[model samples]
Target: MPASIHAAASGSPTRADGRASFQKARRRASVQALLLALPLIVFLLSTFIAPIALLLARSVENKEVPASMPALSRALDAWDGRGVPDEYIFALLATGLRDAQQSGQLGTVARRLNFAQPEFRSLLMRTARSVRDETPPAWKPALIELDERWNAPETWRLLKRAAASPTPDYLLAAVDAQVTPQGNVAFVADNASIYRQAFLRTIAISASVTLLCLVLGYPVAWLLANLPATSSNRLMLFVIVPFWTSLLVRTTAWYVLLQPGGVINGVLMGLGLASHPLPLIFNRTGVLIGMTHVLLPYMILAIFSVMKGVSPVYVRAAQSLGAHPFTAFVRIYIPQTLPGVGAGCFLVFVLALGYYITPALLGGAGDEMISQLIALQTNTQLNWGLAGALSAYLVIFTAIFYFLFNRIVGIDRLRFG
Candidate 1:
């Protein structure tokens, strides 16, 4: 009592000073922890984040045409797109083309433009070749005389648009949309569209694979959970052994089985189930089978893990309470299995979205997915812009799907059963 009264009289707060010291200590510890992690953070940024960021930025940055024809790109900036360009615009183009042609880069400009409007490459190549030796007195008339396409205001407008830096043309084209001559977004004609169809096929195939994994894996998971440990372990070895095998090897095995003269067909034919071998490989059926087989283990494992934890007592109690066996199983057991179901579906769907080798090796021309299309652009056509755009689109789709799935199923609670 005397110490309390004396402390109150002195009015020196002990807790405040201790708190200040504690906070200072905490700050020092935090700094030390950050310093320890700094190298890992820098490494990730340099190796992973930096490259991904650069690729994503390339999807929207367009410099090919503008870089080749700087003078024309600058001059056309002022020319109204309403009618045929003024002499100044033509003069700029004539000189720019001559300079670019001499530098052997005019073809590059033309190639970039041709992606926006067909036949532009030939138009530009012919014009540049004809005028390479002559300095025309009147550039506008010379250009128009060389090619009637030069007279169209739409052509000039398109040229101007194409040379504008950081264009949307490539990004738009990735999704089957185009920047029209009138400066508007329009979908490419149905026949010319490839991205939209590829995206649809990817989604359809992924959804089908997810559904197949769920339908096929759930029963196996339940059986494993109910079986003796020894038997369950042996069965699980079968499920997991596929993972130990090479993906290429597994796909090839499926190919052999699904092929016309392959094992499955041979058996069916010998059993008189069909008159001839079925058309399975090199089609959607082959794509589905390969994807499902590769991904089914993940579903089984996820469900089996969760089911292992669920108590049989709950089902017994519900049955003892006068519920039928099916009702008890459905009401008491299934509700507890939801987390496993969500986890399995989420994993299977996400994996299926990125599947490449199986589809490429097993499926036919029409079964090509977005990843293959991106690869075709990146490798075959060497169109990095389109490839980057498609990648960005896929990333966006995956992120959106993830967000929606998380919202609906509470991914945080989706324990890996």
Candidate 2:
């Protein structure tokens, strides 16, 4: 063979080995990069994803009684609600309470059962105290003598429920529904139906705030986008300055201002806008005012960011084409700002849903949002399951709202402004 052909044949295998080595080296680098990121991925999974999963699980999980009083819980599982559970079930409960009292699990089981029945905490506590030193009792009346709750079929139902796993009771209660005597769901008594009303109030307030923010912020954002740089810079400070104060302080400030005798009413009265102080505080009006004030900046910033990108020349061109000033602005300018409007509304609405301190400070019991109820269930009632249920409800609400809004407005249309 010619010298050139021989050289070419020899070079081919050499190039092939070089290419294979390069591919191996690239694979090794990718593996190293993934290994470097592994710790962060694990950390996020542990801290963020795991806790959220646990919270959602707690909303449905009902293992507290079973884990604490397994013998009693298991015995009650076979119960039919046609009558109060048999005395043997009560006998198992007595033994369990005595053991729980000794083992210090009595209060835990009591509180868990209380979420289902009104007086279970007292019932369990009283029984635990009486049963602490007693032997297993087959005497049903004696157990009933210790507590009248043992005589009620409803109490038995509550205990039977406590023995269950992954129940929908808390979820139903989130919407002001409850399991009936025959194991059917029904509305809670009208007097006690607070959650449905609270949810409606929350949705109404959030929507109102979102609308108000969009309306008020649009004008300010437009002015900011159109104004001289120095003027816009000065005006932007008004939006940014509130962040310097703590959210609690800002909310408290609004509380003081919106109260009947506060600065706002004082000003209105001095100007003779009203003959007397308006009932602005501790109601729906006060909640709207505080939430709008606090959340206005987010809307303004979102819209302003987008509006700044829109050239006024578009409106000018429309006017040059013989469109009236109002028509030009409406047809050309407003259409372009729709993305910003959607962004502002979505941001404000979702943020407003989770606001706790603002509404709690400014709103009455009737005006309270779902977040306040979640906090009440978590803190005062010590009902983690109910709290988790409320949290899950809000999460699901926000997610639905987001997806629906995105479908209508297009998430791709969302802009920083």
Candidate 3:
């Protein structure tokens, strides 16, 4: 071989070896990075992601009837839902009810059924009590004799729906709609409807609070951005101090201050601004006040962070070129501060949507928000399925707002101090 060809072949192998070593090093670095992130990924999966997944599953879960009365549930699978099931299915239901009652699982089935139709729980309980000991010779007539509702095709359809392993009933009810006996989606009666109104009320209150925070925090943020560093740092303490206090404490403090005989009403009365104490507590005003106070700091900090980075020269140049100071500030400074405003508004609004403590304590029945209803379903009603459905909707709303914010303002540009 020629000396030059041998030299080139040797150099090519050396270059190939160096490239392989570089690739190996890069793979090692990537593995190390992944290993470092493993704990955080596992923690998130277990705590946040898993719980959300479970909640979504729970929303559609219809295990109560199937788990408690398996035979009846199995029979229900064969039901066409056109009319009541045949005598054989009725016989199975009787046996299933007897077994469920003996096992103390009848209540679970009844409760699940009652979510589909309000009178179902009472009907099931009455029938179970009647048939607890006796095996009816003819279950079809015996059940109908026990309760006229048993003869209704609608009743059987509702039962079939509740017996299914996974159902949309809870999810539909969460939005103030339901599946009819005819298997059609329809809104509930006006008087019976609540969730849709509650959702709208929640959105309205959150938007109101976001607007209030922006109005109150903007000037403060501008001041912080413009002041000397020492002065600004001192002023920032006012915004940060509230965060150090527990959220509940701040809400409770507002609860005390906004009452009929509270400091705010007292002051107004003493100043002769009002002849009597105003109804501040247990109203929408109190909810707005409490939420705005809690969220104002977030708005201020977000705006201030962006403002701190903004040069003063733009507004100054506009003013120096014969633009009015107010005009220059609005036209130049405000436009630059919008990313922060968007961040602050999105943060405050999303937070306010899930607010329970402030609204529950401060607002009246008319001012009730969706969070209160979720708490009601979980704590008061013991209806996990309904609560999960409500939570699913809230998550969806948050996600929708997040996408809208990202589209309009670019979430990547957001600043939070």
Q: What ranking of all candidate models by TM-score puts the best one first?
A: 3, 1, 2
Best by lDDT: 3
> What is candidate 3's lDDT per residue for 1-417, written digit by digit as tens?
976678687775555667999999999999999999999999999999999899878999999988988888888898788877899989888888888989998888887787777899999889888888677679999999889999999888888888897888889989999887677999978777799989999999999999999999999999999999999999999999999999999999999999999999999999999999999989999999999999999999999999998998998999999999999988888888888898999999999999999998999989999989988988888889999999999999999999898666764344311
Residue-wise C-alpha lDDT for candidate 1, range 1-417, written one tens digit per residue: 576567767986566667999999999999999999999999999999998888778788778777888877877776777889877888888778888988888877876777777799898888887777787788889889889999998888888887776877777888899767767789977787889989998999999999999999999999999999999888888998998999999999998899999999999999999899899899999999999999999999998999999999989998888999999887778878877887898889988988899999999999999999888887887777888898888889889888776665664355322
Q: Which of 1 and 3 is ahead in lDDT? A: 3
Least accurate stretch of 10 residues (summed lDDT) in model 1?
408-417
Which whole-number lDDT from 0 to 100 does residue 161 have in model 2?
80
Give the C-alpha lDDT of model 3: 0.90
Q: Score each candidate by Cα lDDT.
A: 0.86, 0.85, 0.90
Give the C-alpha miss distance for residue 361 in model 2, angstroms.
Answer: 1.5
In candidate 3, list every pair of residues with a backbone clash: none
lDDT at 409, model 1: 61
Off by over 4 Å in 3: 1-19, 411-417
Give the Å error, residue 330, model 3.
1.4
